[model samples]
Target: MNTYQHDWHTSEGYDGGLHHCRKCKRSHQGPRLEAHDCPVSDAEHHAVAWLGHAGLYRTRFDAVRNFEQSVTPVSVDELFELASKQILSQINEGCQRG
Candidate 1:
């Protein structure tokens, strides 16, 4: 079920858009693409980098709490890794299909 887009947006994994940063704790502002809105540093353009982290943590936590009650639940870190892999795979698959 093409869960790539749903997973990424729902989990908030570095989609190259402004989000709620845990460090700076700012969302989007001013223009749409301008990094200056939440520009904390050249590397960290957004103030909401922690949003994805928080999302992944929550997603994984919920997965464990709901599905893996009888088994070992995936850790937050593991969820991030899984999201990354799934996204990359989806991108590559898209490229190939296109």
Candidate 2:
């Protein structure tokens, strides 16, 4: 497990405006940063970890771990679909209320 420290990254040499965070991949509007100046969400970290932990051809099938059977394998496209559904539903609800 790699622990991220604030001092590890800082954009000290370049003129800063908006730099995409290398850690979270979010566009952060701030001074040029060598280290990521944006806050990382637990969900984002977990997602990245899960994606990196699995490969395209390999799936986790270990049975010795706790709650292994409860895990479901989902593709990145599927995740986008789920988020799109949630967002559309919220938009619809807002539209109906007005």
Candidate 3:
């Protein structure tokens, strides 16, 4: 796993504003000031990890067609769960086959 120091200001885009962290020489905006001026931990970065989980196909046309015809909603959570179950089932099937 790649590791980097929590440089919130640089990570958040260095804007010259009041919320900028002088120590880190960076800036923040909106409600970000309320939180600590450090990047979130890897384990806590669920959104990034969730992006890798496949769900709906590309294009709105395909998505609509799938939804209308196949009844497959583009739900990320559902897709992740389905993929996980398929993987586990495949592993179990392989074990049985062996």
RMSD of each: 16.7, 13.7, 11.2
Write down the lDDT of every candidate, Cα atoms only.
Answer: 0.42, 0.47, 0.47
With candidate 2 superimposed using the best TM-score fit, by how many Å does residue 64's alpha carbon deviate from the native? 13
Off by over 4 Å in 2: 1-69
Per-residue CA lDDT of candidate 3, range 27-98, in tens?
556434544434533233322222222344544355455553432333456557867998999999999999
Evaluation by TM-score, superior candidate among 2 and 3: 3
For 30-88, candidate 1 gives per-residue lDDT tens digits of 23332333323322222112224234323334545554432223545655777899899
lDDT of 2 at 6: 29
Evaluated at residue 91, the lDDT of candidate 3 is: 100
Give the backbone clash total of model 1.
3
TM-score of 2: 0.31
TM-score of each: 0.30, 0.31, 0.33
**Candidate 1 wrongly placed segments (more than 4 Å):** 1-70
